[model samples]
Target: MDSNNLDRELVGVLFPGIVKNEDKAITCLGGIRNISQVYSNPSKRRLGLSFQPENPFVRKIYGNSKKGAGVLLKVKVKKVKEGNEIKREVVSTTVVGCVKTMFRFESMCDFQYLAVHREGPSDGPVSCCLEKILPSGVEVIDFMLQPSPLLLIPSSFTRFEKPIGYAYTDKRHPDRSSPEPGDSVHSKTRMLRSSQVSPYTFNLTNELPSEPHEVYVKQKEIKFDLHPRLIEEYDVVKKLFDERPIWSLNLIRYHTKIRLVSLKVIMPCLALYMKTGPWRSTWVKYGYDPRKDPAARKYQTLDFRLRHAAGVRSMIMSREDITTDRERKPKRSAAEAAAVSDEIAEGSVYFRRGMTPTQRHIFYQYCDIQLPEVEEILAPEPPPGYLCHQKRGWLPANTGEICRDHMFRYIKDTLFNSNNTDLKFEGSGNGSSSNSDDGGSDGSDGGGGMSDEGGFGSDGGGGASD
Candidate 1:
């Protein structure tokens, strides 16, 4: 193309493959006769139109020919039938160019090409020129064009929607109007629908490859089972057992050591029957024990007093317990409580004298004698036959030494001897010999007289040595 041609606005329609008949192809495209077929392979017949401000015709058609403009085309086809032949011809044509065409072109083509047209050419085809199949300036191509990976199209032709024969009625493309309702592009547009981007082309950097990364794994022992806390710790044990020779050796060594020490430690415990013995605690419980040590006796008394003091203090300070219990009894006003306290103080010998600081503090804090009587919380006496150092107030003191003496006697009988005639070996032998003499007198001889004489000579020699 020359400088003049470049300066002027130019529009090119690309018919993808070879055109077998230029006249037939031009005729098919130049009028409405091929509108249905044109819509069928819409992307194959792509259009690239230029909008240059220098072109006076373009400037007149589109108000601002400087930046952007729109174009609309309308064509009428007439079909005449003579005898058995039907002829189709382009009779009338109208093409409107305005700013609205730019917006319509962007929407229909994903901003990759101008508005798709199917019905007619922009003006009447009055001029014809011959040009090379491949133009010179198109030599440097950045990337190869292919259909979307998601959508698989075979060799057969498929119909795609294309908006045709537009009129310059509005500057904005109508969003409600769609040729194929469900055929909207699922992929991103060539240019973002933002004004900041170049609407004519796409940015290559944004389409970089995003392959997934491999995760790192730690090489550690494999555990077969999940623990209580779901942690894997004993994995090596299974592996060790799998090694036959190693596991056999380990088992032999462990069992031999266990057997060697087993009898020495276990026999005495079994003989003593310690496993079946009752357990005893060393901790102490208190009542009033005269036999207890002075320190222990003092400790028990102090503990009892402190517990009593705490119960009194709790009754004074706790609002819930005091308020609930007061409602159950006859209600007494503050004035009546004061009068009773004064009367108690005046009449009682203990309160008539001058009070110590502690006694005076207790009297005022616990409402003096106006306080209700508390139930006696007595401790239960320990059972009889219990062996302890403590003494109950009314029950007998523990005579644990008697139990100890009985245990010693039982041990002596088990270790040494028990008096029983049936258990004596010699006594049973003597009784059996005496009973046998009385029971039987007849005797039988099995050896000869010579054999008996030989035995008598051997017995005489044994008696001589003794």
Candidate 2:
């Protein structure tokens, strides 16, 4: 292929490399220093290409200048014959290396290897060899090849220090305050060079505090003695809340007993997804246990529908090797079969779609189900009273809602017994012990009164004196 054809074929690749030292920065393509070096080449017989900022080739080939990020140059090499005859020709270049800037932070300079390809088909044989000269203190860490090109979002949407799964919050807004003091600020990015882009950038706070005073939620102290493992699990969940985007789906296999506690903490953001269909079809699809163990074979079968995020759709068959139809016993009579079919038709539960708010409330309560905003394993509980769905009795004629503190105290009272007697300290003297001390006891002297441990003591003496 010719040079024109090569220019027509455009290809872009991203490579991640490590800098030799943490303190030094990598020099990127089209940098002032690179231009200076190219110009300062000693040999006068040189053929070269420069992808300057305004160069059409830079925009067409690199796709993103990134302030002169991706550029390729091919330089010629000179070969001198015995009697001062010199031969020079352009050399083909591949695998260009440069320092990649970490967003706006130039201080974080790391080496990046970019594979540049122009629209082309060429197999040129350049007999003249270009001397291999590598920059000092530069090393290739790892090479990742991706078929898809990298998708770019505005830098404002993904600032350098912002949390990975959270959207950028503007601190300049007068109505909002900074995150609470205890909220963690640490975050790190994953798949820095992955070509894939997530469709959504989750807002860190779906419901912002209404006022400055409400910005900081008073940390509730867990007064009860809890298992260390439970405490650690709670911390892990809070850390997840800080790290993972709230809307992202997560699968959790949990200890059955602890599942309720986890749901209580994160139910505000959880949404359960349920799929329902004909029992016979679903059972046939998922399969039944054909094992001959009477206990295992006696289990009831129910239909379950699974939704796949990916587009692939096929019925999954069970792994049991036994032939289900052949091993199964035939029904005794047609009358009995008809009776059973009628019973099944009457007893089968039907999940009605698109229920009214009141109907949904009743349905959820009856089914013991609560679907949150994101699907997660959660214990079904009645919705919080503050979020009532009933249209008629929302505000009763003579009813008052309980205060939050009162509810908390009631829960504490129910779960805890008053051990005040053990906590109480009694004095030996009746005067101090029986009556409240208002800076004086009725029968004690005005000065230093009787010491509780020392028994009856006079104002200036150990025993009663004149």
Candidates in order, TM-scores: namely: 0.10, 0.15
Candidate 2 off by > 4 Å: 6-8, 13-76, 79-466
Q: Count clashing residue pairs in model 1.
A: 2
Tens-digit lDDT track of model 1 for 1-466 = 1122223342323443367966654443434444344334343432222232222121111011123443444568999999999999988765533232121123122122212223346564433111222233654443235221222224332132344675868624344233355565753234224222111111212321122111100111111132222121122232332332111111222333223122222211111111000101011111212222222211111000001111122212221233531123566998776454333222111111222111111111011112111000111233443332212111122111111122222322332243332332332222112211111011111111112221211221221110
lDDT of 2 by residue, 374-433 (tens): 011111222233221111011111110111112122222322233222322223321212
Candidate 1 stretches with Cα past 4 Å from truth are: 30-466
Q: What is the lDDT of candidate 1?
A: 0.25
lDDT of each: 0.25, 0.25
Model number with the top TM-score: 2
User: Model 1 residue 202 lDDT?
Assistant: 16
Q: How high is the lDDT of residue 276 in model 1?
A: 9
